[model samples]
Target chain A: MTPPILELSGLTKSYTAGGAAVAHVVGGVSLKVGRGETYGLVGESGSGKSTIGRLSLRLVEADAGTIRFGGIDLRALSGRELKRLRRRMQIIFQDPFSSLDPRVRIGTALAEPIRLHRLRRGAEVDQRVEELLATVGLSPAHRHRYPHEFSGGPRQRIAIARALAVEPELIVCDEAVSALDVSIQAQILNLLEDLQRDLGVSYLFISHDLGVVRHMAARIGVLYAGRLVEEGPAETIFADPRHPYTRMLLAAAPRLFAGPGAAPRTEIAGAPPSPFDLPPGCAFASRCPFAEARCRTEAPGPDSYRDAGRRAACWRSAELPPQAAEESTARMSPAFRRRLDLLHTARREALA
Target chain B: MSETPPAQDADTSAPVLSIRDLTVRFGQAAPVLDGIDLDIGRGELLCVVGESGSGKSVTALAAMGLLPPAAQISATRMMLGDKAGDVDLAGLGERQLERLRGNRMAMVFQEPMTSLNPVMTIGRQIAEPLIRHHGLDAGEARTRALEMLRQVHVPAPEQRYAQYPHQLSGGLRQRVMIAMALVCRPALLIADEPTTALDVTIQSQILRLIDELRAELDTAVMFITHDLAVVSEIADRVAVIYAGRIVEEGRRAQIFEDPQHPYTLSLFASMPRLVAEDVSGGGRLAPIGGQVPAPGNMPAGCRFAPRCPFAVTRCMAEVPPLAAPAGSAGDGHRVACWRAPLEETLG
Candidate 1:
């Protein structure tokens, strides 16, 4: 197996608002992304998934822990070294509208990165910009157009092109497709997948939508209140989630279509606990249906299930049933199941 | 609960709201919404599903007579209540429309933060409608406002009453918005993406609250949303809108089980399913290529023809009327597509 292109360990970050600790936004998040692999980080708002993304690129400094790139410790790097390293690590933000300068032409935006990195010179810069545009499925002629001239989907393509300009090995996608329409979102997701294959670029994909993450990522990490509650292969995590919080998330997510005999969606009884005054225990304990006395008073460390290559941080992980298996099957319609089978066999044949 | 009528009987009764050939155009540009037709029965939840430029919100606004003065709205028949006792919303004066707006019908917008007034207390905001419509005194309205808050399941109603909109969480703010909209018990409620801004857990809670409230009040709901999953959950009837037109409308079961329109079929295909078996292949999503045409550059024929996978020469030359298929159950299932029942043509 190839070594991980990016690795973060024991990462912790906090913020103070009005001279008071608001919350530890990212509390001891650790994960690895191998070369050409997609590592998905899923959580709701304030789960610090975005902060993790920012911290990996050192766009936001962590209060503690280490970030390593290509087996080199990034935290110890000086200003010059960090700047040089940033070219190989890029971030694509959620809102494409605000990310790109409205006044700048698309060509200028793409060329600026290549020029700044000294990757191309003179006429070669324009040629490189056009190549980047074509790579993201946009026309070279669109280079002259302003950001406002393009729609949300194409604007996101432009953002991808800009990220690709620096020839980054590890790109962090922070809710990149959340703002797009479903049809448009599918287009972008397919584009990202195609690029991943052709370019062999690894991704740290962060989103609140588990379905999208499951589709894109090989490995998945479920975050709650700035902590990793579960981590496993995407299939194992989706099929048989161990943590109660992960199960609740899967049950709460609305299905694409209601089957003839689907069960009613499970409702999480209470709102998430405030990050500011989180109790000294499981952050999700208050909302967990199976929370016991131990769950309320003691925080559990990661418990590895060696055979499944899965881990869950819950006191009751051993006792918990595999809730996702039955629910996933019952939620899918027969027609969808048939089409999915056809798609799989067709894909496998093409790959072979 | 006994006072509430049966859902089946109510479905057979005259529609609570009916619209025919409703068109809206701003200035001389192409119509934002053209020849739109819909009928929502009493206590039915009709989901208007579409993407951004599909004019779902415009339909809601036109129904409420809340369109800007410059925008032109025309409808052959826009009636509220049954035919015998119908109220012509199109012909009503501004003064009369204002009276019916919040009393007989109410709207809940997508963002509760902006929809609610920041300075005013939540109780006062909720009580405004009760006092205006029911002729209740301030003291009576305040008491009733607390009851409304409780009905929407806002925790600690008394304490929340004094809090400003800024002080409440997103979920709490939305509950307050629901309380304000339903305080008067309107016969028709138009919710424009009420849970779009909320998290999944909060969104489900709000959806359940809306479903329960609609059942108890027996109020017809016109739910506008871009999320197909939300539509699957809350809608009794589904209307698939595309490029300012209702391409298909049918019962939830019919729409999901046997979709007719190409656009609707593509929408279903585009969504990433959450099942585990499907995730192994890492196949590409089925994307409908191209964008929703700008209002000014809309096609003369079928608006969806450009992006439709089943498009033929005729599909780009003429628009199809909304009609039932040749062989189907006599449910009011309708589709406006030249090549509908796509099984025959595409196969």
Candidate 2:
């Protein structure tokens, strides 16, 4: 698969805060993004999802392991080589408003990246800036507007445009649509999807929102306390998830719209444990309902689950009690239910 | 269908709180809440869903008579229970509103960290509401505060009562806020995004706690939120607000199943689906272009016309009256649109 456009092997990052000893935020996360494949890295807040994103881009130095992009070890690259490598990889931050300098206009923000990468100058730079703006669905006239003048959705579009200016092969979109409204999120998701199809750009999409991840990403990697607990195809993970944590996440996520008899979500009672003080065995063992004696003493390595392509780090992957398969229907607002039902009926007829 | 137990279906004649055409304005500028109307039936939770600057907070603030001095509020009709009659909240004096704020209507703000006093013990903060609103003695208030904390599912209530805001986590602080807001057993409670800052798990717990407490106290609730999912879970009726106006309002089922407004449809379409794909070919998510206009800079005709896909000349040139969309069960369903294609749009 083109040697995986971007690959990370046993990446680890830690921090020493407030005179305390070392705390490993990202213990050892290993995943790969194949050429033109969207790899979703899912985790909760403080789960090292953002840290891994930053580490991949070398925005934050990793304490251990390798980051390989396009057959080059990013960790081993030096000076000009590292900087040159960065031009091909970009990151779209969570908070769009704060990511771009408030003092700079949209056009200027787009221009800086192109200029820094030495991709274009003069007339070429202007044309590239306009192209980037239009690529993200923003009008060229919006170039003069400051960050504050734009809405959250437009600001995010601007950020995406800025990311695309350098024509990066791999873009790390970290919670890109988390702050946006649902309608705006759909627009951005569609934009990103369209861009990927057109540009053949690979993405390491990091987010806490699994539903969004499921829709946009082909392969999914579930992260917990800086460790990759599950990595598999999106369809496999969603339809028949093996990891207990993965199952819990899928259940907790809010469905778009469902009928009256839709199943109630299986809620995980407590929050994820602190990374600094994670338990010795499985990091998720504390919150996992099926935790056993074995789980408390030994962490499970990635093992084949439903297929060879799908792997989950769990002791009870194969022999767990069956989770009651709840009716997986969209939860419609009462007003939308009638419309949704009609639409469903029409769709069925058309399919027949 | 699995019906709720018989015990859960008790009916009452009087709504706990009723508001009509509640308008709050700062000077001559367009009303922040223009002709906003709402009702909270006894023991029912009504969630007001809207984006930022949709006047959700303004509506809550006005209900508590907490508007700034320069602000003007007016309502054709406003009532709290049968006894209070139709007292104009806009005209109510500072002294009367102050007495009613905690005693009859209490509010839980979004951020518990900033809302709770850092210097005071969590116990005292909760107790203060009881002591002032109900005129309870200090000792009794302290006892009641501990009870309230325990009721809100705060473990080791006694120890937590003495701890300051800094010592407790976000979830704990929110519990403390709930305890303080419900200390007086107000007839109506206004929770303004109480769980927005908490994690999803914690958010669910908080919602469950609110539901349980509301049932126990029989207090009507005005829940303000931006998350449609949360509203679907908790709201008995949903109000879709855009630009300080209720574009669509209906029962939870109607709101979800028969959304007529383009904005409402977009909200549902935008929601990330959590199911396996089927013959439906995945419902094409229609994102409404453009931003929600600023309060003062509202459009000439319909507020949502600019962003709506079905916007016609009439929609842009003149304001559309709030009318019932076709195929609605009854009059309760309302939408403000000039040319809402009720049949095609619903599909």
Candidate 3:
């Protein structure tokens, strides 16, 4: 297997707000992003998923741990060296409306990144900006427009164009498509997939939406209370999650169209333990339906199970209540399916 | 939980609230919502599904008589309850509307933090409605507020009652919001993307809570959301809104099983499947090209015609009336598309 583009081991971070107790937002979390791979990091709000995304890019300095990007230890790099390395990594925020400067034209936003990185000069920089606009499926005419002039989708496109201007090797997309509507989300997802295929770029795809994460990533990592609970192939994890938290997430997620045989999702009644005072044991034990006595007293490390490629941090990973094996179908009508088929054809022809 | 909450089977004849030919515009500009019609059935959940700028929220605000004074609003027949207890929301004055609002109908918005007063205790915030609308005294209102909080499943209701909005977590705060909205047990409840700001885990629970509350209170619910999954999860009936118009309406089964409108079809196509693979192979969704038409830039004919793949000359030149197709099951499923029965016409 090829080496991962980004790797973190024993990543830890803490924040003390308003002279209160220090909260370990991320604690000893370890993960990797392989070259030309989309690694999905998914968890609910305050689960440290976003923290990991920022830490990987050195946007926030970790209190302790090692960050290796393409075999270079990021912690050892000086400010100048780190600034040079920033060219290879970019981050896209959730809100496109607030991310860009409203007064700045889209052209200036795209050009600034290229010029700052010194990737291009005068006319070449402008030319590259136009190319980027085209790359994200926008027109060069849109260059003159301000952020307010563009809609959510176009603004997001501009954000993407700016990210690509420096030709980053890996991009951390933190809930990138969560803000847009469904159709626009599809467009952005498709565009990202296309860009990955064409540019051979990697993405550290962070989102709370499992459907979006599953759509983007080949492998998935589930985080809970700043800890890595499970990591595996998307299909395997989605089909049969070893970690109880992972299963809870799947059950909570609403299917677009559910068939009659679909299993009822098992809901976790209480909220996650407070980040400031997380219990010593597994962070999900309180919510786990099959939690054993040891789960509350002893913390479990990320242990391999099912296969070497799959891992779950659970004491009772071996013995849990069996899941209803019914594969929920879309319950799609033949009539509806035909229209979808027609849509694919029409869209293809339109592209042609 | 298992979805389809048994769809309360609300009676059509005596709907809790009904609006016909509702049109809304802002200060001489183009109409934001034009000729909108909807019916909130007694004890049934009707989801108004549309993207941003599609006027779903505007429709709700107009119904509640909450639209700004500068806004121009007109409707042929907008009333609550079909029988002798009917209240004409369109013709009512602000003072009359205020009395009818919390007493007859109430609305919940996306963010509880914005609507909820941070300075006020959770208990007091909830008690305000009871005091103002029901004339409940201080002691009675306080007791009722705590009871309301407990009903929405907030833990340790007594402890929570004393705390302010900022002290509670988002889920608990939202439970507070629901408690405040339903404190009066109003006949009609309009929740506009109430769960959109929350996580999926919290979102489903809130949806279930709302579903449970609607059934218990027998309040007609107009649940507005952009998510098709959430819509299918909780809706008894579905209304597809596009560019300020109802393009389709149907029962949950009818809408999911046999969608007819091109926009609905496109929305279904656009959704990312939860399963391992879908039509475009893994991870890819079929995007509907272009955006929802901005207000002033709306097409003269069909609003969706510009982005629609099936757009024809007739579609661009004239608006198609929303009506049931010839072979459709008795009036339940309707579509506003010139080229519907698409398999026969286009295939």
Candidate 4:
């Protein structure tokens, strides 16, 4: 059995505010992505989803915790070793316009990475650039075009092509398709899925859009105020969400159909609390309709649920109103639970 | 086939605003907008839906007499109707147009962060239109501003009125923009992608607020957006635009359930629904290949012909006139296609 491609143990990232005190943007968190597996990290703004993605690739230095790739501890890697590792772990940014250099042509942008990685050079580099461009559905003729010449969708394709230039094993896509139109977003998602299947690349896809995540991700982790509140298989999370925070997020998501003749929408009542001053207990306790006095005082620790492989940080998950828990929990029978537990235990032991 | 009511049926007496045979060209070049005709009845929310560079925004700007001097806008008739008597908005003098700008026809623009005056207090911003358009005193204007904020469902109107644009959230700022636009109770409101910058939950709130305001004020609305779902929610009727021309116009239900134009079908198919596995086979996406052609060099025939699966020699040779969809609800549903959908036979 192979070790997970990327693993984080008790990762914590804190930032010092203007005053005397330090603020923990991301509290102690732990998650991992295996080789060729897509892990989705979902959260609202300021949830530290983006920060965790950055921390994984060492884009932002984590305050404390261990991030290991294969057998190597990323934190312990020095200058040269770190440089080598960067080629294997790449990141796609949120804004294509800002991420890309305005002055450089698409070909030049794609070539720079290959040159940095020393993958190829001379005519070989030029030929590789054209091939990469064609791979992302852009014609080789578009290599000379600047960022402004292309629309949002094409610009994203160019970004993807640039990410693939070095042939990285893992790419952290941060809100990669959020800004594009709905139709265009589907195209980009499909492209990413196809690329993943063909290239066997792992992705730490970070976004607030759950629909996109559900379609592409096998496992999903819900983050809030830098802490991992819930982590489970995408279908189980969507079908029978045990965590109150996860339920709230699912409820808040705008649905397609709702009223008579109109589609139902997932409407959230209030906004998330500011990250600077988070509440004790659950980060979502303030907005939780079912919050009790105990909820405000004690933060629930992560616990395995109906499926031993599924984990959620919530006190009253089993106590969820009948209808809310009916569909998902009903599907999780004893036989399925035993199977998932056996599979996960084997995978964990192999990693250890 | 049954026909849904036209968007203009709400006001059978006359349209609040109407444009006929409108042609707009920049300099001596070919017309960017060619013979676009539309009507906005009193209290009707008619969304002009299109992608970027589709001239939906341009149409609204033209209605407001805001086109550049270089744009040669010539329409056989562009009328703004009310009980006072319809006026030719296209023919109005600059001073007359200025008077009508914020008084009778107000617009809530996209990107409220930039559209709003950064330095002005929310109260003062909302009061500006009341004072200037209604000739109210500053004290009275401020009072009216508070009322406007309340009307738009801004919580704690008094405190919010004193806050600046930068201090408000994206949703709140858009609401402030709405309050400013509606303070004078304009007969018509033009919102250009007003909620595009907001989150989904916030977008719905804004849409619901707009729906409520339109009902209360009996104000006509011309909403411009690319989100078809939003159009389905708020628009009584929708006009599908491409390359500066309206390719189709129909009642909301008719447009959604039985679209006539190939482009319209493609646009709906392209949108990713909230739930996966509902429509469009698993892993199969319905994205339109290729980019929108540069508006400056639009194609001679149907602008959508290049991407249309049903394109033919005739479609490439000449422009298709906007006509009633075959077997559709009378003139209520219109399409600009050489061939409409054969769904009845195929399905």
Candidate 5:
């Protein structure tokens, strides 16, 4: 088998307060992003999904772990060599407004990465920048606008173009589309898919939004208090999530059309355990509906669901009752569905 | 426009809070809320949903009479059925509005951390409204605040009472905000994206809490959100706002099930479905280009026409009136687009 584009094993990171490791932001996470595959790292805020993304890119140094980028050990590499390897990896943050330089033209922002990587030079560099803009569906005229001059959606497209300028094989999209409105988010999502289809770039897509993640990712990793609780194909996980936390996320996601009547979305009672003083058990055990005495005392290893790639960090996942496939969109009334069909067809015909 | 701005049943009864042709602009800018009318019954959960700068929050602030003094506000009618009787909120002086605020009408903002008093104990903050509005003594106010906290289901209300806003979690601070807002049992509660900042699980809990409180207190709730999914879950009626206009307004079923406006339909098509995609995959979200125009620089005709998939010359020239389609029972399902009932026109 081809080596995964990026692989992390036993990745751990803790933020220190006053030189003491007071908070374990990321604790013992392991995952693999296959070549050109979108690996979704999903969790609530402070769950350390972002930390893992940063760790993979070596943006945040992990306290302990092995990071292999296309078979090269990132941890053992020297700083200078790591800097060079950085050319092959890039990141897009949630907010392009702040992530971008206010004073710089959008064209300069895109050119800086290309020039730094020496992907293009002189007249060719300017030409490449224009090409990048066109690639992201932006006009060359937009290259002259400042970051603040553009709206949220366009600003994000500029960010994406910047990410693409480096010609990286893998881009860590840390909540890239989370800030945009629904319609705008759809545009960006489609753009990302198109870019992936054309460029064959892998993405470590980290988002707190499950729906967006479900749409963008082929494989998913559920994070809880800095721990990876579940990792599996997006379809199987959504169809019948093995882990309680995964099920909780599925239950909590706001669905537009959940059959004819509105269904009351459920929430589990407790907050995630503090990373400062984690229990000597599953990080989600406190909130897990099926947690037992053993689950509260002993940390369980990854329980294999089926293939080597599918697993849940729960002692009872194998014996747990199967979750009914959660209801979501497309339960439209016939009238609504008919109208939507007409809308889709008309929009398509016009675009065509 | 012969028709009045389309109106909802307001939960099948007389409106607890009614506003008509409300227009607001700051300084020399264009109106942020352009002739938008809204109604909320005694216990209705009306959701005003739109993207950023769509006048969702401004509408709430305008109704609460909380806009800054610089806002040049005008309205045909802004009536609130306060305990005192029906009062025109627009007619009230700032001082009069202040008296009615937190007493007869309350607001809960998106970020409770900012909306809440950071320096004050959560308990004191909650008790202040009771003391100010109900004329309760400090001790009585404290007791009532604790009860309110409990009602909002804040764990360990006694301990939380002594905690500052910074000491509590995001969800807890939100609960404190709700406790404070509802302590005086206001006639109307305007929650503007109250859960947008929270995690999904926490957001669901807060939404559930608001739904319960709205039901129990019969507080006419104006829930402003950009999330159509959230609207589907909690709204009794929904008003889809765009560029300060209510482009479409209808019952939740009518809006979600049989929306007619191109903007509303596009919004529905644009959202990525949550889970069903796994079961039946091969689906793509409709891509509607163009951002919501800034208030001061809105388009001439249909606000959404710039990005509309089916826009024609007429859409660019004529501002479609917010009215029911050509032939339909006037079920308060109004749409502001020339190509309504798209199945008929497009198909």
Candidate 6:
């Protein structure tokens, strides 16, 4: 098997609060993304998913962890070496509006990275910018326009183009398409997938929306209060979520289409505990329905489930039944089903 | 507490709020909301679903008489029903509307932090409506405010009542907003993307709370949102607005089961499916081709034609009126399109 493109071990980060106590934001998170593989990290706000993403790129330094890219320890590298390594890993933020400079022209923003990396020089830089724009489905003519001139979808395309300009092997997309409308979100997701397939770029896709992560990621990790509760193949995790928190998240997400007489969605009982005041045991113990006395007293480490590749941080994962697949069945009303089927068929025909 | 009769049972025939030929425009620009006709029955949750520039929020604001002074609002009939009777909200004076705003009708905005008064305690904010509208004393209003907070299921109602908006979490702040909006038990409630800013778990809980309150108090709700999944969960009826016009309006079941308008169908197709396999096989999401036209530069005919897959030359030349499709379930199901059923037209 080919080596993983990026790997981290025992990553931990904390910030001092007030004058004395420390707030653990990312605690002992370790994961890997293979070449051209998307590793999705999903959790509620303050789950430390974003912190982990930033830590991998050294945007936020880890208190204790070993981050390796292509078998080189990032922390051990000198400033010069790390600067060169940055060209291989870039990040696309959630808000395209704020991520790009308001005054900079779209072409200049795309060209700046190319020039910084010395990827191109002189007249070739403008040509490269136009090519990047076209790669992301924007016209070459759009290069002259400013960031504010484009809409949300186009602006996001520009951001993606800028990220691609550096030709990074790994791009950390933190809620990359969450701000756009649903239709526009689909376009951006498709563009990301196409870029990954064509350019062979791995993504550390971090988002709060599980549905989108499931669509874009090959492997998934469920984070709760700065800790990874589950990690496995996206298909396996969605099919048989062992951790109670994973199950609750899957159930909590609203389905695009529900059956004519589907049951009401189940919601997790309470908000996530603050990272500043985490419990001694499982971070999700307060809200876990199946939590036992031991769960509140002792934290559970990642344990292998039925599958060797699947791991969950729940003592009862071995005993828990597989999730009911009823949620996946296309359970639209007959009339609605017929209409959607027709629409899908028509769409496929048009695309073909 | 006075034994108030069930609000839903009072008038089954008359709608809680009704509007016809409603139009709104800013300064000299094109109209943002054009000829929007809507009706919300007592206790009914009518979700106005649309994209950002589709005028869903504008409709809600216009109905509440909350549009800015520079904006022009005109409607043939804009009636709002409450305990007193039906009042013409469109023609009412600012002073009269001020009396009706928080008394007969109330609104919950997308951001609770911005809507809430930062300096004021939650108790004072909630009690303001009860005291000013219902003529309750401050002490009595405070007691009722605490009860309202408890009803919204805010933990530690006593403590939360005295705390300011900044002290509460997003979910809790939204609950306070809900409690405040319902304190007066206004016949109408306009919630503009109330849960869009919240997480899924919190969003579902808030949705459940709103559903329960709607049933318990029988309040007519105008829920404006861009999410179809949310609309499916909460709406009894849905109106799909596109470029300042309602392209389709129908019962929730009817609309979801058999969406007639191309824009509605496109939205459903564009949404990422929960199941990975469903999304994986498709090469690209079947997104509508173009962006929604800006208000000032709207097309002469169908506003959605530029992005419509089934658009014809006729579609670009003439605007379609909202009418019942030929073989749809009932008059309640209406579509504004040159091509009513896409399957037939596209084929």
Point to the candidate with the largest TM-score. 3
Give RMSD to native, each candidate.
3.2, 3.8, 1.9, 7.9, 3.6, 2.9
TM-score of each: 0.95, 0.91, 0.97, 0.89, 0.95, 0.96
TM-score, candidate number 2: 0.91
- Stretches of model 1 off by over 4 angstroms after superposition: A304-307, A324-352, B1-11, B82-85, B274-282
Write the residue-wise lDDT of candidate 2 on A1-352 in tens digits: 3459998988999888777866789877778898887999998777789999999989999999999998899999887888988889989888987679999988998999899888997999999888888898878898998999987788898989988888989999999988887778878987988899899999999988777887888899998777888889987787778899888876665444432566665655776777668788888898898899989888787653556688889988887655644324533344345444444444345436
lDDT of 1 by residue, A218-264 (tens): 99999999999999899888888888888988877776655346666
- In TM-score terms, candidate 4 sits at 0.89
- Cα lDDT computed for each candidate against the true fold: 0.85, 0.78, 0.86, 0.78, 0.84, 0.85
At residue A67, what lDDT does model 5 achieve?
Answer: 97
- Best of the two (1, 2) by TM-score: 1
Poorest stretch of ten by lDDT in candidate 4 chain A? A325-334
Rank list by DockQ: 3, 5, 6, 1, 2, 4
Interface RMSD of 5: 5.8
* Residue-level lDDT tens digits of model 5 in B106-187: 9998899878878889899999988887899999999999999999999998998998999988988888889889999999
Q: Write the per-residue lDDT of candidate 3 for residues B146-175, one digit (tens) a residue.
A: 999989999999999999999998888889
What lDDT tens digits, residue by residue, belong to model 6 across residues B69-139?
A: 98999999999976789999988878998998877899998899998999999989999998888899999
Docking class of 1: acceptable
For A14-49, candidate 6 gives per-residue lDDT tens digits of: 999898778889888888898898999999888898
What DockQ does model 4 achieve?
0.18
User: Interface RMSD of the predictions, in order shown?
Assistant: 4.8, 5.3, 2.4, 13.6, 5.8, 4.7
Superposed on all Cα atoms, model 3 deviates from the true structure by an RMSD in Å of: 1.9
**Which DockQ-derived CAPRI band holds candidate 6?**
acceptable
Each prediction's DockQ? Answer: 0.43, 0.41, 0.61, 0.18, 0.48, 0.45
Q: Predictions ranked by TM-score, top down? A: 3, 6, 5, 1, 2, 4
Fnat measured on candidate 4 = 0.23
Ten consecutive residues with minimal summed lDDT in candidate 5 chain A? A258-267
